[model samples]
Target: MGDLYSELLVKRERTAKDSLVKYGLIVLTALAVFAGLFITPLLLIAAIILGIACYFVIPKTDVEYEYLFINGDFDIDMVMAKTKRKRVKSFKLSDADLAAPLNSHRMDYYNGNQKMKVLDFSSGNPEHKRYGVITRLDGDTCKIILEPDEKLAQAMKNSAPSKVFLD
Candidate 1:
């Protein structure tokens, strides 16, 4: 059979809290600039710097997660601002100790364990369904949270029937 290859890109959605924070920063910057204009020219320069800082910090960033499933291996990439992209993680299907829906009871046993390393590759939107992957690393089962497409899930199940859990 030919190798199975699939990719999915997930974009992050802004939260209400993020909007509130951005607006709060803008209001504070405006207040600072107004006060600085009335106080001193030096103060105005300081306010300009503050405004620039806020501009870089408060803007809602666009982040996209790229998931690639090739054969039995899964790779995750993080794309920031539509320009920067970096590989986040990669794992083989056979290495997974447990793979299940994020809300499934199959993850209950490992959820509370503090020793396991947890990596979340999801889009950060709670509305999107995610999957949980537990793989053995350094004698500990590391938890990986990801959003996989249907074809990727099928490919995983076909490669490792005993480990992949879709329900």
Candidate 2:
């Protein structure tokens, strides 16, 4: 569990840095465009407008974790900690008899008691791809971040099982 937490922290930091870089580039590009229109003041004015537009168009920052645990029963939680604001969603496993399959794609599980749902992390899902929950010997845990892909997102939307569990 400690290792997993550490890994998640590292990944979160890296993501923050990456987002900073991406936004920085957008701002820089906008400025460059404005500067290039030095001769035509109207073009510079247009560039400024475009820059402001781009800044607003950028996606909002979201740093969250989708975690899964398997004990005598399964537990799932989503942790979002940013700017000292914390949000959490937790649920328990519904199908005690069925073991979650091992795959490199996102999987959805439901909590029978709470009727809530959780999604396992996968490299192929942009939303849930950043963190992977791995179980180790002696009940230890590890969390890993993987590059983002679209396959998992498509699968989650298109291939997710209609009947999750027959309880």
Top candidate on lDDT is: 1
Q: What TM-scores do the predictions have?
A: 0.76, 0.29
Candidate 1 local Cα displacement, residue 60, angstroms: 6.1
Clashes of each: 0, 0
Runs in model 2 lying further than 4 Å from the true structure: 1-90, 95-101, 104-167
* lDDT (Cα, tens digit) per residue for candidate 1, span 1-167: 58878888988676677677778777877777888888766677767877887766564355688998888888888887777788978888788888988788998998888888998788776667788899976676799888877877787777778988889
How much is 116 displaced in model 1, in angstroms? 3.3
lDDT of 2 by residue, 24-94 (tens): 75877666676766655666766776677555443323444433333222222333334333324232223
Whole-model Cα lDDT per candidate? 0.80, 0.36
Q: Which pairs of residues have clashing backbones in candidate 1?
A: none
Q: Weakest 10 consecutive residues, lDDT, candidate 1?
A: 54-63
Worst 10 residues of 2 by lDDT: 2-11
| C-alpha lDDT (0 to 100) for residue 58 of candidate 2 | 39
